[model samples]
Target: MLAAAVAFLFLMQSAPAALRSATAEPRVVTPRGDLAADERATIELFRNARDSVVFITTRQRVADFWTRNVYTVPRGGGSGFVWDEAGHIVTNFHVIEGASEATIQLADGRQASARLVGVSPQHDLAVLRIGGAGFAIPRRVPIGTSRDLQVGQNVFAIGNPFGLDWTLTKGIVSALDRSLPNESGPDIRHLIQTDAAINPGNSGGPLLDSAGRLIGVNTAIYSPSGASAGIGFAVPVDTVMRVVPQLIATGRYARPALGIDSDDEINDSLKRTFGVDGVFVLRVEPGSGAERAGLKAAARTVRGVVPGDVVVALAGKPVSRFGDLQARLDDYRIGEAVELTLLRAGERRKITVALGAGTE
Candidate 1:
């Protein structure tokens, strides 16, 4: 056995040099600081997407301690981006709200005066126009389809959080179709939630995908101390696309409406009295589609409480909440007709109501 082992060791020592070289090639390793494919993709996306980001500044006059009118120092600042070559810049309504003047700070550090082109306080989005030379508008991000967004899919956000301009953050889709409040009282719907770090100045910035397409507009963050707490919300690009074009053309988003105000507040007593789920008919506008369709409202007479027609559906769609009605109605253009399902006099009836221009 000893003689056989010695012969085997001698043979191993005499192995071919080409065999050893081939084995060493298999151990050829990359450098330690090399980035993974995903990390490379992220860096590339940020580089490509940062150019579209912009900084917003607004100025307003305020009375000093002397109560004299003076030029107030610039205070309001946020993030926005170019929406088109027409000089329409999209940002949060809160960013430049109550400002006398506005400016757009381009990624190249050139500041240009901008005008409030249009605003939709209901959706918390605003459009500004910078009509001058020497200000090269960045590429407007093409709107991507957000309806197919899946959880765990990567997303990127570029904003000027905490006055830090063009800060890029990446994360996965945390949630979707969330509901958040706006100036119109929670009328904004179809929000996109992300765990990405969205800070104060991040509002009105773009939320991009791996392909760097605009998927949403960073709007709000859920935080106890006004800083990012791992939860953030963005206005879906679909909604922004639907409103921005109209805003560019007319400086306002003209959505269709039923021209009637329904009782949005639902109490136990009201629900029990109406024998329906948390909805009541408070009033119907005269000469409106609701009135033309013979829709009645609850009356307060000397007798017991009377219930009017209960709207269970609109346009063959169930409306369990007031915001649902608003969300559905927002999809329709002005002057479009819609059908409504009403329960009146213990009988269900369907009526077609032509939508009118929204007063908003």
Candidate 2:
């Protein structure tokens, strides 16, 4: 009975292993299959979109150490897209930064010198006009509203990354209504974030929707490696639509400004010292709205008068940072009246200030 029981236990273990092996199917290799519907659609859009995109190169004079002479050098490069039939191509201002010369390279291997007709550093936008006629620049991509973009919607990006021309990448919208710093402005607000691959030279290129509409301008990406790590940002189409028209019409963007020029930034130290949470007024411009409204700049006894107005709120919206003021002004036109909450003489007061044209 002991021998029979030991044999039965061995059979149970061996039988299960044998049965498992018998049931396991052999690996089979198959040929590569066709792309799925979404992939095919992406490919089609890329083909159509590639024609509209172009590579921009800017040249600057650099001193050559070896030759001990100054010469023109390729300063930098970025992407651009056809804007209109008048030969206007739109790109980022930073793309052409320090550019003594600008040129556009088309997908068909046609290179042409371009003229910088307009540049708005405040908006990071520029317009380049191609020389010579008869080149049918691709259609002005239909602009889609970015205000309705929901998180996780698929997004597509095409640009010349690292000078590698015409690259396509896909991802989803990671966020919206983001704020970031700009070279010309205090901060760029209401930016759109995506996981699409945006890298160097991708700036100023179009970020498109699934239907191939121009959604935003691929501007920046968040990556330490300087490569796309599933985090990218873009300037929304609404801003583009708003800025480009004036840029093309006039050679520069003229934003309405608040006549009063005061410090826009406020920090914790400032909050504790000043006992306020709104923007700390550095100085109220003479003959400006703040001055006209009897606004006084904050003063310190030891500092011998560092006088400026601290902005606490604008039209009921709290102003914690200077960017808040800039953003609020961006939404309004010139000659608009806005209510302000000012902290003067360690006391809070409400005042009205009329916005005027910004410095040209």
Candidate 3:
């Protein structure tokens, strides 16, 4: 009886301490201060630009032969931004390349149908207009010139990366004047390169300067694994500013053209055979500016095939390759006169040709 009484007394002494230990709370550490100055600026930039950035989804019509029915299937999607108070949205051309329809999701989670306004495939940019009523259009993005942008300057990208809406990435301009080929048009030139973590769904989004002004349109990235590899290219805003107006007006951007078709392979062969470096004028389109300027085409004579006028320069800019000619002509506008230096036989001649609109 005496031992039982001592055991009960020990249990009574330890029971309260055991219960206290079982219900104890853990301590947690958290950030306690406000953001830094630059951090706050970045946050504010995203806040101002979020409404302008938008999410795009595309649909294509697929026909079922056996059922004799047509269905609209989900195709692909990317990003875009508000271009004006008129409700125009700007995005990459490839985003809606073959789509029959598109849907736009706004920052406020409202959805609307979008119609293709115009597209400049050469620059890989497209404009869309939102349809339906009662939906408020977001504020347009502030435009900035790429000509004054310098390497190492801070840049930002806002897009729906992987369908995650309103994501913002920050980085610096890595380079300028980068070139990339378009699938359906002329090579895209004068591109702005950055390392802003642009990914597949980031295409057609806006690349902004530190002031939250749109500097470029994010289009392509350099990656072997089909993901961003730190090198991403955007169509410069100067080109966008020039092309978008034309698209909005005419539903197409007419590139300035000389209207001469040159064979790059033949030009290379001619360079080796004739010991000259110039684009070989294989054929000149009839009624074109080149033909009007008396640009001759390669002809087959009785003795042998003879080379025609090889374009050597355009307005004092050396035209060593066929792409160089296109790049130089792009700097001009339709009906603008540009001096062309050509080599015929062994003599060089200068002629002025009025630029024409490219059929592309």
In model 3, the number of clashes is: 0
TM-score: model 3 vs. ground truth: 0.88
Return the TM-score for candidate 1, rounded to 2 decimals: 0.82
Model 2, residue 250: distance off in Å is 1.8
Give the worst 10-residue stretch by lDDT in candidate 2.
260-269
For model 2, what is the alpha-carbon lDDT of residue 7? 100
User: CA lDDT, every prediction?
Assistant: 0.82, 0.81, 0.89
Evaluated at residue 282, the lDDT of candidate 3 is: 85
My TM-score estimates for the predictions, one after another, are 0.82, 0.83, 0.88
Estimate the overall C-alpha local distance difference test score of candidate 2.
Answer: 0.81
Candidate 3 overall Cα lDDT vs. reference?
A: 0.89
Which 10-residue window of candidate 1 scores lowest in summed lDDT? 18-27
> Which residue pairs overlap in candidate 3's backbone?
none
* Highest lDDT model number: 3
Instruction: Order the candidate numbers by TM-score, best to worst.
Output: 3, 2, 1
Q: Rank the candidates by lDDT, best first.
A: 3, 1, 2
Residue 314, model 1, lDDT: 83
Residue 155 of model 3, lDDT score: 96
